[model samples]
Structure formats: C-alpha cells, structure tokens
Target: MAAGIEHGRRSRPNIRIIAWAGAAALLLVPLVAMQVTQEVAWDVTDFAFFGGLLLSVGGAYELLVRASGNATYRAAAAIALAGVFLLVWVNAAVGIIGSEADNANLLFAGVIATGVAGACLARLQPRGMARALVATALAQALVGMVALMGRLGVMSSAWPGDIFAATGFFAGLWLLSAWLFGRAARA
Candidate 1:
C-alpha cells in the first residue's frame, strides 16, 4: 500500500508535465501546418503571439490546479481558463461579434472583464465562486442578448447566427461553471 501511494504521488507531477507537453504540441502543430500549406497563412508574429498565449494560459491553469485544494475551485479555475483561451483565440482569429475589425467585437471585452472581477470576488472559494460564476453567466447572457439585437438588424452587416452561436456557447459554459460552483458550495 505504501509503495502504491508513493507511485501515485510521483505520477501527479508527471501528469502535469505531460499536459503541458500536449499544449505545446497543440500549438506546434499549427506552426508546422502553416509552413506546409499556404491556406493557413500565419507569420512569425502570429506564431510568437499564439505560442506565448498558449503557454501562459496552460501554465496558469496548471499553477491554479496545483495551488487549489478544493476540486470545485480547481474545476472553476479550469473553466475560466478555458473561457479566457477561447475568448482570446476567437478575438484574435476572427473577431467574436463580427470579424477582427468590427466595433461590436469590443463588447466581448466585458466577458473577460467580468471574469477577472469574478475571480477577485470568489477568491477561489466555493461560495464566492458560485456567486462569481452566476455573475459571469449573467454577463455572458447579456453579451449574447446584445449580439442577438445586433443580428436582428441593429447592425447592417453583422451576421446574426454566428454572433448568437458564439455568445450562446460561452454563456452556456459560464452557466455550467456556475452550476458546478453551486453544487460545490452545497456540498
């Protein structure tokens, strides 16, 4: 039993290292693919920016996981990390509300801002996280509503379905995170 326990302890760090390695590979694959295909079209600056972003996001997630003892808090952090990554990637790749150039895309910043505030409010505690997650979900839902309005002809050129799709997806994630936090708080 002691030997088994010792083996399990050693494997935790190994799992973390493996996770980071996978993150690096996920970023590297696009770099190599871009080199081989003209369709991908990422330059050096794009590579550097995305590579750094991936590393920082993945490293932050790992740090939070190691720092938090509560499974609920860890899961919440993971969800927030994922939300940030997706937001950044989508914003960088092709604007969230429209394309990279649309002014409406600026509203997406609120989602990230709310998340930052939520983290501070929650302080990685289950009850606080529950409150924070609800706030985040509400913010996300508001963003979706605004996008829906923009899609309904408030904006002439914006695509309704795409905007609604992205907003709803992120909102759903926030809601799920909120539910998890609520469950954790109850437990």
Candidate 2:
C-alpha cells in the first residue's frame, strides 16, 4: 500500500507535464502554419497564444477537479469555458480579433449558447455531461473548419484569418477539455 501511494505521488507530476506539453504542441501547430504560409505576420495577439492560454487553463481546471473530486470545480470549469467562448464573440464583434466578414460573432454566440445549454444539462443529468461536453467540442471544430475555409483567400476578402485561427485554437482547447472532463468522470 505504501509503495502504491508513493508511486502515485511520483507519477502525478509526470502526467501534468505530459498534458502541458501536448497542449503546447496543439496550440503551436496552427501558428507555425500561418507563419510559414505568410497568411499573416506574427504578433502578440496571435491565435496561438490565446489557444495556449485556454488549453492551459482548461487542463488546470481538469487537474484540479480530478484532484479535489469536487462538483463545484467541475461547474466552475464549465462556466470558464463558456466565458472563453463569449470573449471570442466579443473580440469578433469589435474587430479586435477577426475580420468583419469572418462572422466570428455569430460563431462564438452559437458556442456560448451551446456551452450554456450543456452546462444546464450537466446539472440535470450528470451521467450525460460528458456527451454534452463532447458535442460542444465538435461544434467548435465545425466553427474552425468554416472559419478556415472562409479564410485562406478562398471565398472573399471579407473572411478573416484571425477568426479562423481563433476558432481552430479553441476547437483544440475544447477537445482537451472534453478529454479531461471525460477522464475525470471515469476516475
């Protein structure tokens, strides 16, 4: 029993490090792609940075929820995820993040709505919460694909690459969130 406890203690940090590294890689891929393609010049407000931050936060939330085994932590994580969606929407609306044509506002609004609905469902049906979270993750992926296709100079000049990048970044984050939440549920 003592050996098992000691082994668990030693393994926790390794698990966290692996999670962080994976999140960093996911966040960096698109940014590197953008820089290589010259789609946009690198800047501080780049989507990769935001993506990394969101992933880190989501991962941290998961770790905390798992460690504490607290429902409140899970609820807070859900709320924080929703807040991130809302922030993206606001950024798109003000033209601070994406182009006018990207329609980030609408995409983010849908995400926010879905996230809120998922949270509500989670409260009512804990057993199916993971499914709701997974659905939100997929929705984010759809938004990313739309944003990406609309950008890259495919449809029109109105499409914004920044918005596409943001969506893609958050989609990755949501994927991480779903995995973490699912794992927590299982454990």
Candidate 3:
C-alpha cells in the first residue's frame, strides 16, 4: 500500500473504464454496419449475444487476474483468456467442423466446458491452472481427433486437414497457456 497505490501496475487513469468502453465500441461496429448495408443484417439477438460475450470476458478478467502477480502470470492469464475467447467466438460463428449448424460442432463446446470445469477445480491457482490447461489442451485435441475419425465436416474443403489444423492451432494455444502458467508457478 505504498503511497496508497498498488505497485507493479502502471498508474494509468481510467484503464478499466477504457477497456469496458472499448468493448462497447466494438459492439457499435456491427450495429453501424447493419445500417450501412443490407448484407450485414444483424437482429437484436445477435447484439445481445455479442454484448453478453464481451461482458463475460471482461468480467472474467477482472475476477480471475491478480494485479499483484508477476508479468509471467499476467501474460499467462491473457493468453488463456484470448484463446478461450477466440475458441468460443469461432465455434459460435462458423464452427471448427462443417458449420455452425453441424451437430459435430457440439464437441468443441465440450472443450470449453472442460476448461471451465477444470479451472473451477483448480481454484485458479498457478500450479493447478497449469494442470487444468493441460487438460484443456488434451480436450481440444480430442475434439479434433474425434472429428477426424468420425469424418466430421467431410463436406467442407480439405476435410480432415482443416479439422486437424484448427484443432491443432487451438490445442497449441492451450499448451502455450499451460506452459506460461507453469512458468509463473515456478517463479
């Protein structure tokens, strides 16, 4: 409590406010685009969904991050959050499998569920987070393996390769997050 302010963090004014405002501004883009073109038609439900997602992401960051933690920890948290955010966004929008409408896409949902459940189990501790993220990486890869073996998204271009690539990319991100968390634990 030196100088009645937290150290390690830069004394930047309105950073949290700016982050929330920026998130709100992003929602405006789609709203403005809908006004600009008929092709960009987005209903009220779409706006609600996106708004909810952004709020949840921001809220999660605020809740899970420890401001006093080391840079490695912060980086680990950011990487994990971004990875999860992109995973949910891509899965919801186009899906890693054939399309958003495909039943196979449901598998990706489990990957997210696994991570959330593991995070709960770990209580967000660094060592436990590292293990939880490893579990998440495995879950991500398992979804891809299932899609490959089950011939999911066969109608899509490059079939198995796309599944492999997408799943591999996400799994790699999870593994990297896990590695970072592990390093943070060590430090």
Judging by lDDT against the true structure, name the best candidate.
Answer: 3
lDDT string, candidate 2, 98-163, tens digits? 544544446656765675587577762333455565677677667667656655334444456555
- lDDT per residue, candidate 3, 1-187, as tens digits? 5553667665657666887898999999998998888988888898898888898888887777654257787777778887887887887788789987888988877888888888889888878888988999999988888888888889987787778888888888889989988998898
Worst 10 residues of 2 by lDDT: 93-102
Residues forming the 10-long window of minimal summed lDDT in candidate 1 = 149-158
Candidate 1 steric clashes: 0
Per-model TM values vs. the true structure: 0.83, 0.46, 0.88
Local distance difference test values of all predictions, in order: 0.75, 0.57, 0.83
TM-score of model 3 (CA atoms): 0.88
Output the lDDT of residue 7, model 1: 48
**Going through the candidates in order, what is the number of backbone clashes in each?**
0, 0, 0
RMSD of each: 2.9, 8.6, 3.3
Whichever of 1 and 2 has more lDDT, that candidate is 1
